[model samples]
Target: MNVMSVRRAEASRRAGGDRHERTVWPFAALVAAAGLVMLGYALLAQPGWLTGLTLTVCGTNPTAPHAVLLAGVLLMLAWGMARGRQTAWALALCLLAWSAAAELEAALAPSPAAPWRLAPLGFAIIGLWHGRSRFRVPLNATRLKQAAEISAFSVTAILVVGGGGLFMERSHFETPVSAPDIGRTVVSMAAANPGPAAFDGPAWQINGIALLSGGLVIVVTGWLLASAPAPRPAGRAQRAIVRAMVSHPDSETLAPFAMRYDKSYVFSADGRAAVSYRVLAGMAVAGGDPVGARESWPGAVEEYCTLVERSGWRPAVLGAGPDARLLWEERGMRSIGIGDEVIVDTGAFTLHGRSMRNVRQAVHRTERAGLVTEVIPERQLDPGLAGQLRRIHREWLGAAGREHGFAMNLDAMARGVHPDALVAVAMAPEGYAVAFQRYFPAAHAGRNAALSLDVMPRTPLSPNGVNERLIVDMIDYARSHGYPRISLNFAAFRPLLARARSSPESLTGAERATIRAIGLLDPLIQVDSLYRFNDKFQPGWNPRAVYIGSWFDLPRFAVAAFGLEFALPYDRRRTGRAVTAGDPGFEPLKGPAPVEAHRAVRH
Candidate 1:
C-alpha cells in the first residue's frame, strides 16, 4: 500500500509539471515581475552595499552584482519568448548558459553563500526550453542586429563597471590589487594577496577577462551571421528581368505597373517570372497578378508569399485578374470581385452600331470642331514635342490635384518615353497640342497583341469630345498595325450593381443591401459613371478582384493600397483647387482649370 501511494504521488506531480509547462502566461507574468524587481534593484540598490557584501580582504568583487543583472536580462528574455519572439528565445538560451556559468563560479566559493540565487533562473530557463515550440518564427536580420547590439553593449557596460571599481580600489589602497588578484577574488571569493610584488608580472597576465569578453563578442557575431537576411528592394538587374518576363502572353492588363520605379520585384530562379509589390505599414501589397509565363506563375507567386510570411508581414494581392484570383483561392484565400477591366477589340471596334450612337456623335462633333488628331509611337516623338507634352502632363496633374498612383497610373512621365509606348495628340485649330493620350505596350508570346491606355491629359480650352476622336483614331492605328486589342479603364462592380438596380427582383436581401451601399458610394468613387462611360465602347469586361488572407487585415490593406495611389498632404497642396479622385478605376475630376473632356483613360 505504501509503494502504491508513492507511485500515485509521483504520477500526480509529473502531470502537474506537464500542465505548468503548457500554461505560458502565468509563468511569463511571474518571470516579468521578477525582471522588474531585478531592474529596480540594479537601478536603485546602493553600490556601496553591493561592494561591502562581495568585498575580499584585497578589493571589491565586481562580478557578484552581475549575476543579479544577468538574471534580470534572462527574465526579460523569457517574457519575450512567451510572447513568441524567436530572437528572444535564442537570446534566452545564450543567457541561460551564461547564468549557469555564473552560478557554477558562485558554487565553487569556499562557502556556498550565493549558489541559492540560481533556483528561479534555472526554472525559467527550463520553462522556456519546454515551451520552445511557441517561438517558431525564425529570427530575421533586423532582430539579429538588435540582439547583437544589446549583447555587445551589455558586455561593454560590465567591463567598464569592473574596470572603474578596480581603479577606485587601486587609488585607495597602499597595496593595490593586481588584475589577477581581482580575477581570483571574483571567481573563488578568496583574496589572492600575492603582495605588491605580484604587480611586476607581465601585463597580458591580467587573467581571463579579455578572453571572456572576446568569446562573448564572437558568440553574438556568429548568432547575427546565422540569422535570416532581410528582404531587399528590387534592383536594376531585377528590373531588367521583369521587363523581359512581362512580355509573357497571359500577363494581365495592369502588368505594366511592374516596370514602374516605386515598386519591388521577386523572381523565380530562371527569371521567367516575377511578382511586383510594395511594402507599406507592414503589408506586402501586390497591385495585380504575377507578370510571367503561365507555367512559371505558381512558383513565383509561392516564392513571393513565402518571402512575405518569413518577413512577418501580411501578403495581399489587390486588383488581381480572374486567373490570379482562382490561383489565390486555391491557396485558401477568400477573394472579393472588386471591378471589371474593359478590353476593346480593335479589329471589331467601329462607330457603326446603334449602341455606339453617343460615342460616334461625340467623335463627329469633335472632328467638325477642326481638332486634328495625330498618333505617333513614343520613341518616334520629337524631344521638344515630348517636353511640351510633359509640361501639359504636369499642369494637368496639378489641376487634377494628384501626385502619385500605384495600381494603375504613372507618377512620373517626364523621365522619357517607353520604347513600346504609343502617344496620341489632338491639335486645336491654332496647332498647339491641346489633348494627348499615352499607350503602353501590352505584348504577349513574342507579339504586341494589345495597347494599354495610360495617360490622357488635355488643356482646359480644348473641345469636349477630343478623347472620343483620339480613341477612334487609335483603333484605326491599331488595326493598321495589326494589334488586336486595346485595354481601357477598369469599372468597379458595374454589371452586378447595374443588374441589381435594373432588375431588383433577382437579388437577395444581402445583394440588394450591398448594391444600395455601393450605389451610395458612386458619387464619391464615381463607380457608376466610369462603368457607363466604358460601356459606350461596347468592350469585353474581364473581372478583377482583391483577395485577402485575414479579414482583420482589410483596413490595413486598404490604407496601403490607397496610400500608394493617392497624393500626400504636400501633394494636395501642390494640386491647388482641383479635387482629384478615381484611380485604379479612372473617373473624371471636378476642379478649377479642368481639362477638356475626353474619353476616360485608365492605366
Candidate 2:
C-alpha cells in the first residue's frame, strides 16, 4: 500500500471513518469540565463538607447520593473516552441518558441549576452520539471481563461486609439509622466518596475499609481507561507463514527472530514481506529489518508504521541494519547507531598473530583445566545435555528476568525447535557441560551458510574467558563444517567506543561526554566491555541502529528498550522455579554474582 492509502486504511480501521484517529479530546475536555462543574455545585451549594481534597470534591448529600457517584464516574469516563474507547462512550451514553431525564424533570420543577446542568448533559450526549465512530477502539476482551467480574464481586462484598459493619457499629453514629440509610452510606463510601452518614467519633475504621477495598477497584478502573488498542500477535499458523518468508536466503541476519512467539507482524499485501514487533509502554519496537523480498519492504514498512500510528503507539526499530535503517529513515525516522553486529569470516579468522595472544592463551588454559569443547547439531542433542544447557542459561541469568534482548537474543536454548541450529558445548572431563554457545544459521550471500550466536552462558564458577573460548572453538568447528562465517554478539556502541579507546585525544567534547555517559551504564548493560571483548576477534563490524518515528518518541522507546533488555525489578514469573539471588539453591546455581540483569564486564 502507498503511504496515503495506508493512512486511510488505518484511520478507517481505528475510527470507522477515514478522516484521522485524533482522540476526541475537545469532547473529553467538555465532559471533564461538566464533571468539574457538578463537583463544584456539590461542594458549594450543599456544604456537606468532608475533610481533605478528595472528599471536598465529591461531597455528600443525602438528598442526592447519585450526584456524588455521577461526578466521579464522569471524571473517570472522561479519561477513558479521551483514549477513544468505545466502552467509555457506551457507558457515558447510559449515564447521560439517565442524567438528562433527571435534569429535564428538575428543569420542569423550576430549579435554577437544572437548566445549567441539562445544557452540558444535552450537549455531551449529542456530541458523543454524533462522534461515536471516532470512539471505535474496543476494550480488550480479557481485561473487560476481568473488570466486570471484579466490579460485581466488589459491589457484593462491600455491600455485605460494609453494611454489616455499619449496622453493628450503629451506636457510634451521630443519629439513628435504618437498613436503607446504612445501605446507601456503605455503597457510596465504597465507590465514590464518603456517604452522607455522620460519626460520633473517628471515621478512620470506615475510611480504612473503603480504602482497602475501593483502592483496588480504582486501580482496575484506571487500567481500563489508560489501555491502548493491543497488538494482535501472530498465532502458530501466522508464525509458520512468517517462517516461510524468513527462510529466503537473502533475508536479513536478524529476520528469523521475527518468528519469536512474543511478536506481532504486519505483512505486505503481497504476503512476501513482513515486519515483526512487540509493544511496550505504548511503544511498538520492531527488532530488525523487514523479513522477505527486498522490493516488498516499503509496503511492509508503510503498513507497520500506519498500524502503530493508528493504534496510538510510537514506532521504533531496534538493532536495524544499514539497509533497514534507510528504509525506516525514508519514512522520516531518526536513526542513531546503537550497536554493531560482529562477524568473523571463518576462512580468514585465525589466532596466529600477537593480537590473538589473549584468546589463544585462554583456550589453552581452559583446555588444560580438563574442559573440552564439542559441537552438537540441534537434531542430535541428548535430552539430558539439553536440560544442562537450560540450567546454564538460567544460572547465568542469575537475578535477571528472562526478557533478554529484543533484537539479537532469541531466548532459545532447547532442542528440536531449531533443526539447523548447532550447540557448542564445553564439557569437563567429569562429563558435565560447564559452558555453551548456541548458533542459528543466518547465511545471506551465495557463499557458505554463516551462523549467528543466540546464547552464550555458563556457570559463574567456570573459568574466566569461557565465552571467548566458546567463540574460538565455534569458529574452528564452523570453518571445517563449510560455514565460512560466524556472527557473534551485537556489541552496543562498539565502533565509536573502540575508536575512543584507541584514540582518546581525537574525540570531540560531545563524544567524550557520550562515552562517559555510556560508561556509567556499562555496570548494567555491559556495553563498552562487551564491545572490547568482541573487538579482540578483529571481526568485521556492521552498523546497527535504533530508529524512532519522531524525536519525541525517544523517551518512550529508550525506556521500553532498556526495560526489555535489562528487565524491571518486579518482573513476574509464571514458572514454578525461582531465579533470584536470594532464592534457595541460587548461590550454588549462579555463584556469588551480585544483583544485575546481565553479568558485569567479564562475560
Candidate 3:
C-alpha cells in the first residue's frame, strides 16, 4: 500500500466511524416503532377478547376505553415518529403510558389468565428498551436474555398455580371424602348443615371480586405512576414568564395597555406609581369616538386619584394630556417640571449651528485624545463591559443621591422590563467607561427614541456641555442606525424652572398673588435653583398644563392647609397666556404691599 492509497483508506475509515456513531439512536427508534405497531393492533382489533381473557383470570375487567383510544393515538404517533417528527415522539410517549397501564392490569387479572400471562413482561420489556434509551443502560444481547428470563419465570409460575388448582378440584369430585379427611383438603369445603344447604349459598363472591379488582387497580396505577416521564425543566423564557406573572403588578395591571385596549396607572409596593400618559392612543386605535377619548381622561384621572388616596403615594406621569393636568388640580395634587421631551427629525437633522457646536467640539476633543467612538450592532455590547457600565451607574447614583437622578433607569433594566430597545456605551482611552444610553423605539403618534446618559462618577467636570455632546453622539448613532427622532425627558417640576426664568414684569395680578402665596409657604428658592440647572441645556421650552373636569372636586382644605408651592397653570385658550410662577401679580395678604398694590400687575 503506497502512502496515497493509505491516506485515502484511512479517511474512508474515519467517515464510516462517524456514520456508525450517528446510527444508534435511529436504529433504536425503528425498533420502538415496530413494538408500538404490534401493541396498537392488539389494543384496537382484539380489545374484547383481551378484556374477556383478563376478566376470566383476574376476576374483573380493569382496562378502560380511554386506554384503547390512547393506543390508537400512539399508532398515529408511531407513524409520525418513523418520519422523524419530535412532536409525534412526545405524543407517542404519552400513549405508551396508557398502554403500560392496560398491560399491567392484564398481568394482574385472574380469569382466562393464560393469554395475558405474558402481557406484563412484554410491556415492561418495551418500556425498559425504548423509554430507558435516554437513561443510562446496557445495550447488548443481555436485554434479549433478560426478556427471555422474565418469560420463563412467568410461564413457570402460571403452570404451577394452574396445575395445583386443577388437581385439588379433581380430587374433591373423585370420591365421597369423609368430613375429617376433607377438612385437611388444600381447598376449603363447605360444612354440612341440618337442613339442605340453600340452593345458592352466599360465597363472598362480590367481596372476592372487589379485592381482586382493587389489587389490579393498585398495581396498574403504581406502574403508570412509576413509568411516566418526568417533565422537562423550565428554560429562560419560561422563567421570565413565571417572574412576570408572580412579581410584576404593572405587567398584569397594564396588560390592557399592551393589547391597546385601555390605559391604567399601577402602584408598586415602594409607593411608586407608573401612570400611562398616552392611554388615549390605544383607545384611538380601537376606533373609539373622539368624544369618548376626551371623556376617558377624566375617568383615568379619577382612577389615579383613587389609587393615590388608597396607597398614600404620588409619582410622576408621562405624556399627560390637558385633562390629566386639570384632574390633578381637582385632586389637589402638586405638579413639577421633571424633564422635557425632545423630538428630532432623523433624516432632516444636520450637525450645524450653536446646537451642534458643543457636539462638534466634543467629537474633535475625543478624537484628539485618541479616544474612538464606534457605532456597532447592539448585540456586540460585551457582557463584561455591560456589567462595568452598570457599576459606573451605581457610582453616579451614589454621588448624586439616589433621590435626585432618574428613578426608572436602573430599576427598569434590573427587572428586564424593556427588552425591545437598543443600547450603546461609550468607553474612554483607559477602557474606563464614560457613558451609556438606552433607546426605546417609538409607539403611538410619535416616532422618536429615548436616550439616557450618565458620565463617570467622581469626575469633577461640569455637566454643562456634556448633555449636548451626548445628544450629538446619540444623534449620530441614531442616523447611522436608521432611527428617526430622540426624546429628552423633562423634570417633573418643570414649572418651577419656567417660573424662575420669567421676569416679574411679565406676570398678571392673579398669577403674582398665587406665586407669592405659594412662595411664602414652600421652598420656592430651592426649586428655582434646580430648574436653573435644567434650563442651561437650551431645550425648546414647551409649557404643558394639566386639565381638570371640575376644580370643585379637589381637596380645597388640604391645598389651603399645606400651602402647596406649585400649581398647574390655568389655560386661557384665547390669549394663550398661562398663569405661571414669578408673575409680579403676587401681593401678600399681610405683607407691606397693600391689597390695591397688587392691582397694577399685568403681563
Q: TM-score winner among the candidates?
A: 2
Question: RMSD for each model, in Å, please?
Answer: 13.9, 8.6, 28.5
Off by over 4 Å in 3: 1-349, 354-359, 374-380, 399-417, 444-466, 480-483, 491-538, 544-603
Q: On residues 23-67, what C-alpha lDDT tens digit does candidate 2 reach at each position?
A: 488767866865675566556664433223323222223223334
lDDT, residue 482, model 1: 62
Backbone collision tally, model 2: 0
Preferred candidate (lDDT higher): 1 or 2: 2
Q: lDDT at 580 for candidate 2? A: 30
Cα miss at 321, model 3 (Å)? 4.5
> Can you write out model 3's per-residue Cα lDDT over 203-281, one digit (the tens) per residue?
3422232233333333332222121121222333332332232122222111112211112223223322223321111
Worst 10 residues of 2 by lDDT: 591-600
Q: Model 2's lDDT to the true fold? A: 0.70
User: After superposition, which runs of candidate 1 have C-alpha atoms over 4 Å from their true positions?
Assistant: 1-85, 91-137, 142-233, 399-403, 444-448, 504-524, 567-603
The model with the greater TM-score, 2 or 3, is 2
Evaluate model 1: give its lDDT: 0.64
Rank the models by lDDT, top first: 2, 1, 3
Best lDDT among the predictions, by candidate number: 2
TM-scores for all candidates: the values are 0.63, 0.72, 0.35
